[model samples]
Target chain A: MKTFFLSDGDLDEFVTNLIAKSPVFAPVAKKTRFVFNQLESVEDLRLDYDTTILPPKKLFVPTKQDLVTFEHGKYEECLAPGKKILFGVHPYDIKAISMMDWIHEESNFDIYYHSNRKATTIIGSNVQNHYKKAFFGSVCKELKVMGHDMFLTKIADGYLVEVLTKKGDDLLPDGNFTDVSKEQIKNAADVNTKADENCPSKLKNTSLEIKHKIRMYYDSDVWKKKSENCFSCGSCNIVCPTCYCFDIQDEWALEPTSGKRYRRWDACLTCEFSEVSVQGGSENFREERAERFRHRIMRKTSFLNDKLGGPACVGCGRCSGTCTADIADPVSIINEIMEK
Target chain B: MSCSSNHDKNIFLPKNAIIRKASQMTAFETHFTLKMEDESEFIYEPGQIVEAGLFGYGEIPLGLSSSPTQQGSFELVVREVGKVSKALCALKAGDTMTIRGPLGKGFPVSEFVGQDVLIVAGGIGLCPTRSMIRYIMDRRDEFKDFKLLFGARSPDELLFEDDLAYWRCSSDVNYLETVDKPNDRWKGNIGVITTLFEGIDHLDPATRVIICGPPIMYKFVIAQLAKYNISEHHIFVDLERRMKCGVGKCGHCQINDKYVCMDGPVFRYSDIKDLEEAI
Candidate 1:
């Protein structure tokens, strides 16, 4: 784990070089918010911003991905994107990606997700700014600088670049550098502590406790009351990094002999998400809006945690920020349940 | 069962299978016997399901209706319910379809040996249970007392009529049936499946009851079984859910924390009794 000091100009040069060789995705300003987009140049990279509109998960599991293409009876698995680099990811988003990795690996071994993950190089940056709604500080105590190829921490004049992997070593800038002394490490730690403290929201209970509380309140009227204004727009699911539920369909070309089978992101909040009609047109499951609401919360805090060993919600607060009905915030929801 | 083929190894990929025979069982249901293109045996347990479909249309999970003892081919009794099943019903003999299976946990027939077997099936729910019934019939000497109780909305909706008649005449097997609304030709019991259990003289404590039906039927059947003093551990149930990927990645088939595709399409009643979504 070698650390180097790079000037602001040197950091820009390194990003420019990396973009020149391969595709580089970094956060850029999108009106009032930020989004992860392909960096045409170093000018678009926004390392000083708060959280992006969507997590870096879209880089691996895109909204719609082709699983296979078929011609009559034969089919071939679709190829994933080539080698690319994702830059300026925050620690919480990195944790979400790791959770997705565990989920895709432990279950069916999703080759589509794994192939994209292998191709993409993750470069995480320390959060210099915090979103007003984000509660990662309270629930994400274990968040650290790991699961990334390189981690960049802001120092006085430039950036403290810590190359953490072999792929990271290749992206190192050829410039004058100094070993990160104990004092520099302490400074980085201080910055992280300050960032954590700056987070405005907090959860009163651990995720495990929240999970148990959810089971106790499984049939509570709180779900119906809280979700009364829900439009079922599913913005909460669309922006979630750990929401990996999808619907698979096959599309035929003009020639019926050839077609493509693909999967697109699906939301549990939607009315028809779990509707399966048997003979005589009778749907068997998940018919109520309140049940759907409870399902989304349970999936984030309890159901997925039971399977993946961690909460699916990373407390990034994108769902709450994007919710039109002023619901879908895990921190508020869990806090309300804990209060009861 | 040589397990050397690429399609057999990959959980996602479907192997090319041809329909060796096909017939309409009822107005809505069709029966098909499918064999791999290479003529390899599609080995599967009685309660497991297969992902079956055409290339243009997507796949859906269908419970395997044939016994494992039957080699070289497997059977599926598909009701023309949805898009995938409608397409499957349209196929005929020699028609090509893709299959990836047999997925999920099947019935534990080996553990039922020397025990009185009680089977309860309702409507098209009889499809998965037929495999188990056929398996038990093939190895009849291995098990002790056998009882089959079937219920349908009407005589028209009843499945496997020939097999039902055979079991009715077999001295070693006790077969009883009922319908919700009887017609002019109907002369048997006219009630729900639970009513068939009322006259039973004895429900052996060692009986392993396998039950399959729509969600509504489970409550009534399980309650009746409880009256007979059948312990939860001795009762096995096959649950049905909307499944996309039978290997468990797709979340469609999950019931609470359990993925029905992986943890089971079949589970011992005791194992899933506490799961609110299961029953």
Candidate 2:
């Protein structure tokens, strides 16, 4: 890993070059909130944004895409879209993408996620929107910085660029960046440290303790109480960067004989998530709202912890912000369980 | 169509198969025989499942009803339940559909070697059990006495009537049948499946048992089996869950941490006793 310093003007020029070279998608203004969209110019890149409405995972594993096409009796898989640059991703999203990479290829390989992930280059950055802290709590410090090709840290006079991968090295232009001084390097460390320290609500218990509490409270009334106010609108599931459940279906084309099987993001909170049709009736595994609420919590705090080596929740606080019922917040739910 | 989306690592992509035969088995169920378009051997064990569906309709997991010995083709007895199964049932010969896998853990027949084999199928439970019993019968000398206890709602719903008649006359298998409500033509045992256990109570501890039926049948069958000294691990069951991706990411078929697609559609009772959602 090599760290270099780029003055503010040079950094702007470097980013402008990147936009000119490839299709750069970066965070930009979207109404009152912010979102990752294709950059029209270097000026459209908003490094000082609190959070995006949707996590960058939507770019990697799209909301909807065709998986296979069927013509007559023949079935063939559709290749993923071409390569592009995923720019200005936050640290939490970087971890989310890495987790997506792990779960997709951990056991049974998912060619869709695999090829799409390979088709893009990720440029990560520390939170520059330091005015409002949107931290994931103490676990934020524990979230590993990985799965990024290149990373940027905003310093007082310039930006400290850390080229972590070969892709990052190849993307670096000839002149803008220079060797960093000791003080400039220390300032860069503080900026990254601030990103981890920016927690809104802290996790009182240790990671293991919280996981144990989640398992112990499986039969607890807390879930029922929490789910009572829930709307099941799937806002939480939709905002989550790591919720990868999906539904597959076939859509007909203009030609009667041709159709394509497509997959779209599925929300586990909905009745359609686990409904199975019986002889003439239907059966749903999680029929209760409490059970659905409990499932999402257990999945985040305990179920995937075994495989991903930590809680799946990145503490990005998007769920809490988006919930209309205001009960989808993990901070209160997790804290309440620990107290009980 | 491209090399990147090729079948090598594309686990979700299904194989093209033509419906060789799709005949009505009952009022609600249809028997479909599929021949892979390439005419390649479809290798699999009993108790394993295939994601069978047509293009316009989505796929559903159906247990293979025929023995793996029947290569270049396979059989599935699909009960017309949902949109997918209904579409499958309506399909006729020369009509096309798709199939993925032969997936999940299948019954371990080698472990039943030299042991008394008991297969209990209630109604459509016979679908997954058909291949197992047929495989065991093909090599009867490798095992001890074979017993099949089948119970359907009525005489009309009793499936595989031809196979039942053949087993009744064979000395290798002790075949028993019952119906919840008998008709004028029926003269066999008339009761639930648990009632037949009374006749075969003289069981050995080494006997291996497999139960497949509705969720309610498991409660009674397991209770009946518990009375004997048979090892709990010796009993196995096939459980179902909602699944879209057979590769475990869809998150629908999960009970606790166990992915029914990967961990099992067939799990030894002892191993899955702790999973609350699994019955």
Candidate 3:
């Protein structure tokens, strides 16, 4: 509920103190790309980085998680991790996390996801630099400035920190930040506006237009032709911030009486995602790659949007960035549809 | 960390139920009467399914075969096809199993009151419709012109022989059965389930037809129903999907935008006819 200014040295001290309080995760450079990892030192917090290889969603809904452990006839649930601070998340990713929160909350109320979400304090930052693949400017134009506990925006020689929640106010009691003037706040707002405009990639059609067109094009040749070069490796799904489809499995111990029931991230692009074995063993479902490909687009653009109030894709561009076959980009596909 | 309080809110936690009676119905099907540990009544409508499974094995969706009118205990007719169904078949009396539900949308029975009722069940599809048959029979005075047309692959595959005999002898109801192929000892009309419709002379437009069978049996049965001039909205069918979670969270049971677990397992033909993957 308050805005303050922090110098470079003061910001570093604030991060160091936050890390000491709890485990902090932030983006760090990994050779040629960036990744979200545990912040061991203040220097590893890449506030000015373009994008992370995988979105911070992994911390909330993990790639693999145990749902329940059973021994004999008794059952025990796997608890969520303790409280932690997720530092330096981008605006688009923060938006994606909010979408995931809504999804898990509205349907069946997934305690696993809700526990982790309640435990973590998100500290988001405005996009100071845009990646070559990112197209958030077109799809996610009106970004929320107040979803996280705190949002940091690069302004002049220092950072403008807007404390949004009560948790963020607790972090500021250490007296590491100075009171922000009206001019400084205005300057910070201008910087964010300019950064939004500077996104390298763009979508030709609006998100709503794309949503309506996707339903009509369910039987289109675009999916079959574009997915021709697809490897079905599920890299797009793995790298996506909003792809939350999972497969449930049971693993038994050697004793046969003890085992764990777990869920792991599963992709629609994979052949087995929609397969169900019936009598005499037959997979009688979405058996074609083209159907699976169309499913992914329909889910992101139309199905989820119709139910959840927004498109599932945040335009973070990780799917496009990670796809080796170069067929997973939503912008390119959407633009192709616009041309037709 | 402390997860005890959160575990209480976990929707996946299944209550323990004991099998009171287990009987082999057919070569591939086993019927079990399950009662909750506390001996409490599990109230549910006809056509609703329960997630039943063992501790070591995972859960599978099984339609309730017993009537909602039956208190304290319910029946499940499991076709021993998959791993979970096979495990359920091996379960005997006094064996413990976990159950979560009375989940999914069920048949609209209240709407069928005072209307001509036609029930078409083929093979194991009779399991779910058995609940409806029992419920309707219990309130037989409220309904009119009750007709049941059942078909099985052969004489050996017909489920609930005892119930069939009662329905055949009952003066108030009309029961017609046909087999795709008859055995040497078989004595009945032999053809697909649709052929049974030709025996009746008067076709009522107000008749509400409920059909459940293998996926392939739907189109033919629906085509025959059209000859009777029944509206699409008048015909109701129960669809089966891979329902991993009884709740809508799991995407497995989804057909397009509709989650079969939440939106329906029982839908009117008019409601889901446009959904290409639903049938």
Candidate 4:
């Protein structure tokens, strides 16, 4: 691993040259919110931002993708991982990506996710400003925020660029590099320490303890009360990085024989998520609103934890913030369950 | 882990298959005989399912009906309930479709090698169980006491009538069928499947009972099985769930910690007895 130093003035020139060379997706202002959009100019990048409205998951598994197409006696797959650099990703989002990797590769390999993940380069950045909904410090207390190819941390001089992989070393600037001093290392460490201390929200228990509670209270009536107001609106699932459920469909053009098959994002909170039976009276296992709500929590807190070695959630707060119903906060729900 | 590796296999891609024959079984049900494009074998167990559908519609999980002993092809009994299933029901001989599976855990048939096997099926649930019944009959010497108790909403709704007639006469199986609403011409027993269980004798705790039917039927059947002192471990249940990828990545088929598409569509009663979502 190698480290590089970039002063404020040097960073501007480097960012400008980098964008000119390849496409870059960095956090940019979406009015009041931030989004990871393609950079039109170096000035549009906002590494000092608080949080993005959607996690970087959309980059790997887009909301919609055309998988296979059949036309004129020919079958074609429109599959490719368009090369782009994802710069200024938060550490928690990287943890979510690691979980997604494990899921897609655990049994039947998802070429769609693997191809995009391989093509994109992730550059992680420390949380310079905290979001009010975030509680990463409470749940993932010991998480190091690894898995990024390169990491950027704010220092007194400028930015401390830590090359964490061979790809990171290859992506480094060609020339005009400066050696890192012990003082710069200390400044980088302080930035990371402040990131953790700045978290404003926290659950009543650690992720593992919460996992135990969720399993023990699988039949608790607390879920019924908390999910009372759920509107079945899936905004929480759309915004969360870990919500990877999808629905597949096919469409034909004016010509009946020619068509394409595609997949779109799906949410388990919907009534039909587990409804496989198309017989006379349909059999939807989680047909009730409260059951669907509990299923979501079960996945994050227990079902996935049993396999992923930790809670699937990284405390991104995307679900909590985007949920229109005030009852979607995992922290508040878990705390109520704990108290009961 | 860094994103430096690449994977080549696309599990979502389905294989081309041609329907050898398709005919209406009931008003809503259509039975199909399908073969791979190359006439390759569809070696699948009793409880395993394949994602099958016409290319222009979409795919849905359909449990295999034909036995693995029936080489070079397989059969499906699909009900016209949704877009994909309706399209499949409409497909006829020589029509093409896509298939992706031999997936999900199947019934533990080998474990029943020398044991008394009691099969209980209701409505269309007999489709998948038919695979095992055929397999067991083909190798009848390996098993003891084979009994099949089946019931349906009406006599007309009962599937695999050919197999039913054959089983009633053959020494290989002791079969009984009942119906909730029997027609005027009907002659067999008239009641729920559990009512037919009393006619079966020489049963003990070791009887390997397999049950498949509507979700509401399990409790009654399991309660009836308790009278014979059959342990939950000796009973197996086949289940179904909405499936997209057939590989378990889509998450629609998940029930608690188990991906029904992976861990099971078939499970021992003792294994999933506590899973509230599973019936």
Candidate 5:
């Protein structure tokens, strides 16, 4: 509801104090890129980083975590919540996390996800630097996740912090900071708009012909030729913020009596992902690597058009970045299909 | 839409259903007649299925064999191939099982009223077809003619012997049964059920054919129906998929873009001919 401008010196002091007081995670420079980790020093908070090595989804849904543990015919699931703060998130990654929030809340609400989500206080920042591969600003106008409690934008001399939720209001006391002058607000808005304008390529202006041509190119030879290098390691799916497919497994104890039942993330790119309980599963579905390649595109664009309102892909570019074969970019596939 | 303070929102939770009757038809198959505690009607269409379970073990999808027209008690004929089914078959009459269902899209019988009906079932796939068979028998006066054809691996595996005998006595209904192999005591037709179509003129081109059974039986039966110049829309079938969560969320039992649990376990041939995952 209210905004305040903190000077560069004050910004450092504020971050240092927060890190010392709370369990805070911030973007730290990792080789050529940045990653979210425990903020040991104030300087490690890379406010100008374009993107992180991994999106902040790991905080909500960990890469490898137990769903629940059980013993002796009694089952107890832990949908535990914790208190923490995540700082310096880019708009695109923030948008991806918010989309996951909606999915976990709708219909069959996931208790495990919701609990962790409620405990975390998100402090998102406007993108000051653009990753070359990012096209999200054009697709969805990369804006602050309205769901986040506290949001920050970099201005000329300092950072402009906006308090949007009760959690944000709690962080800011009565006399925390003075007025966010009109000049500061105007300058912050200008920098944010300039960043958005520079993010998307000129290709965003053209009409996409991918969907119509993809229908015709379902049996095309291009996919087969291109997908020959795929190893089916499913690394792309593991890194993606939107790939939510999973497999359920039940584990009995060494005594063969009682144990835990849990679900783990699964990827369609893997051979065993679509296997049926019965014999002779649909090898036809994933017979060729190209079919699997094209099916992922169809699931994001068309199948989602019928089920969920929008395409499932948020244009985050995580799949393309994670793919070892350099053939997973749906945008390039879309363009090629359209041209054909 | 029916949210209330007293009403529990969990549809996945099972109600206590006691197995009132259990009969062993084949070495690998058993029929369990279950009745719920509330005594409310578990009203559902012909091809819908229910999830039955033992408390600490697990659950499996079992097709509803009894018709919705016959309420109070429902029946499921399960072939014991997996762990859950094998555990289910071990239970005798008066055993309790938890059940949640009457789920999924079932065959549209109202659309087939007053038209000639062709019913075909193969092996253990006859369970869902039995629902339609019983329904058609009850409402026999509303239809023109009824033809039933069933095929199993052998004569000893045929389900519902008493009901089959009663149908044989009915004047409006003509039933033909076949097995892959005929033993010394066998006196009926011996071959695939498709062969029983020879010289049989019971169905008009306007007749609606409802067939269910194993996945392998569908294409062959469809080819025979097409030989009679029947339109794809006139033929309906039920599908079996690995269904868990009976609601669409579990992500199993999907056929292309459709969820078999919600969009259909029953669908017209024309509706899903283009779907790659469909049989």
Candidate 6:
């Protein structure tokens, strides 16, 4: 628990030194929201932000990743790692990534994902600004502690940085900062307590209750009426912090003799997501629009909890914010389930 | 832990296999004999599927039809029903394809060795059960009796004609086949796969029954098998789902907490009878 404090000026100096040395990825301004991007300068980083359009999971399990390359009746697996610094990760997002890590490495273990994850350094920051629907603290107390090489908390006039790993210790430039005092430690704890108090009034850890309500309403007609406007656009999946479904494909060169096999992010919201060779599609089991809608919610509530200890939703509010049909808000759906 | 050892222990990815032999058994279907790059044998029990992929194309779950006793290569009977299989059917001999499997939990062959085995296959469902048929033949001395009740839509739709002929001639096996619609030359039973089970002799209560087919076939076949007094534990079925990652990471293959790719593509009927999604 190596703790240090840096003034706003010193923070800029540290950011500049870190960017010059390694590839640092942090949130940058996009239109009205923010997105994780490679930091080129101190000014490019946003230390105080609500949430990014995409979670930091993309840094490890990318949208499109090459699995192997084959040619001329021979095949060689290509597994590469990217050296990076994942910056500005909120605790909820970190919690989501940790769950994903467990899933990818649990049974069979994914070499591609595990290798990429090893080469990256994770830097987490306290949530100074919470999304309107954010409620992860109640679900898992994720805001208090998470898996990160480094954690940063905003204080009155400076930032309290806690280095949790050797990789985090290596990121310090000049290594000159005010030593942590008792008062500074108390300030860090107060900031975290305030963040937990900021959750929306409707949000609660009644997750098991939500699961029961969802099961009771599995056959309800309200889902059909609510999901009628969906175009199966898959925006909810694309923006979700925990959705990890992918589609693998081969890309042959123009000559058709050789190519690389790769996998890209896929979504159940898409019509062809369930297409297979034996039967064209198995999603027919849940063919109705309403059924698909309920299934996604069921995944976040019951299925993921059964598999990974708790719900997969980090309560980041990205799904609700990105849905075009205006019916993808998970909190609203949970609220409706609770009403029953 | 060291990063290298962590990665070395995580090589569960599918390997590329070559199509050593291929044939169009039906107008819409083709059977491919696949061999791994390293030439290692694909040792899998009957009623398992591999994630077969055509490079530059896509992937789909195809049942393993060849017996594991046959070393160095395995067989998959592919139907050109979708984009991936359509591409697979277009490939010829000597062409290379990618695959990852022996993935799902296959049939409990060890548990059924000395008992009577009743196999019911419907339409193309005969593809998976073919593995069990070949296994029983390879180790004929170990089993008590072999009975095959298979059905398809037409004579042309029946899979592995040569193999069926071999099973029909074996003394230890009682083989019967039917087609839903018959031609003038056809002289066998004329009904669904379930109807053929009615004419078969009494099966022991310890007899193990294996079924593979569309969801609609299970309800009828299991009901008919139930009359033979076989307990649910003695009954097994292979349930196929759309699987992308055969390692169980992908949610597409899920039926409740069970991922058809890992937990099972094969299951004891007693274990999954309560699973509403399974027939």
Overall local distance difference test of candidate 4: 0.84
TM-score of chain B of 4: 0.95
Question: Per-residue alpha-carbon lDDT of model 5 for A1-340, expressed as tens digits?
Answer: 8798777778777787777667788888999988889899887788888677777877877765445445543444645667878888776667667767766655455656667788888988988777666666554332235678877888877788888899887777522455788988888888777776785432232223443455567677887876789888877777676666665555666766556545566676776655444322233335457767666777655564433344556666767777888888767776666665
Q: Compared with the true structure, what per-residue lDDT tens digits does model 3 show for residues B1-279?
A: 012232336767778899999999999899999999878879899999888988677888888999988888999988888777888899999998888888888999988999999999988889999999998998899899999999999999989999999999997779999999999999899999989988988779879989998888898999988888998998999988777877777677778888887777889999998877777
Candidate 3 C-alpha lDDT tens digits along A102-129 = 7777646788888998889999888988
**What is the C-alpha lDDT profile of model 4 across B196-231, one tens digit per residue?**
978866586898988998888999999999988999
Worst lDDT run of 10 residues, candidate 4 chain B, spans B1-10
TM-score of each: 0.96, 0.95, 0.94, 0.96, 0.82, 0.92
lDDT by residue for model 2 (B1-279), tens: 012223247887888888898889889988888888878888898889889988878899888999886667789998999888888888899987888988888898788888998888899899989989888888789989788889998999988778888988989899888899999999999999999998885778788998898767887888888888778799988877786777788888888788888788888999988766677
Instruction: Give the distance in Å from residue A132's predicted Cα in candidate 6 to where it truly belongs.
Output: 2.1
Candidate numbers sorted by TM-score from highest down? 4, 1, 2, 3, 6, 5
lDDT string for model 2 (A176-266, tens) is 8888998988998887777667655667777788888789888888889999987777789989988988888888888878899888998
Worst ten in a row by lDDT for model 5 chain A: A201-210
lDDT of 6 by residue, A1-340 (tens): 7899877778888777777777889998888899999998878788777889988888888899888776775667777786888988988888888887777777677888877788888988888888776766566542235568988889978888899989888887544578888899899989988886777624543777776677677667878877899888888998888898887777887787788878788887776665554544443554567766767887887776766667778778888878877888887877766766
**Order of candidate numbers by DockQ, starting with the best:** 4, 2, 6, 1, 3, 5
lDDT of residue B182 for candidate 3: 97
True contacts kept of each: 0.39, 0.62, 0.31, 0.70, 0.05, 0.48
Q: Tens digit of lDDT per residue, candidate 4, span A235-329?
A: 88888888899999999989998999888999999888888655666878898888989999988888887667788788878888888878788
Is 2 or 3 the stronger prediction by lDDT? Answer: 3
Q: Please tell me the TM-score of chain A for candidate 6.
A: 0.93
- Two-chain complex of model 2, DockQ on C-alpha atoms against the true structure: 0.49
* lDDT for A18 (candidate 5): 77
Local accuracy of candidate 1 as per-residue lDDT tens digits, A206-315:
87888899889988999999899999878999998888888889899998889998889888888887777777786747778788888889888888775556677777
Docking class of 5: incorrect
DockQ, candidate 5, comes to: 0.23
1 or 6: which has the higher DockQ? 6
**Model 6: residue A210 alpha-carbon error in angstroms:** 3.4
**Which parts of model 1 have CA positions greater than 4 angstroms off?**
A140-145, A173-178, B1-10
Q: Each prediction's DockQ?
A: 0.42, 0.49, 0.37, 0.59, 0.23, 0.45
State the lDDT at A180 in candidate 5: 87
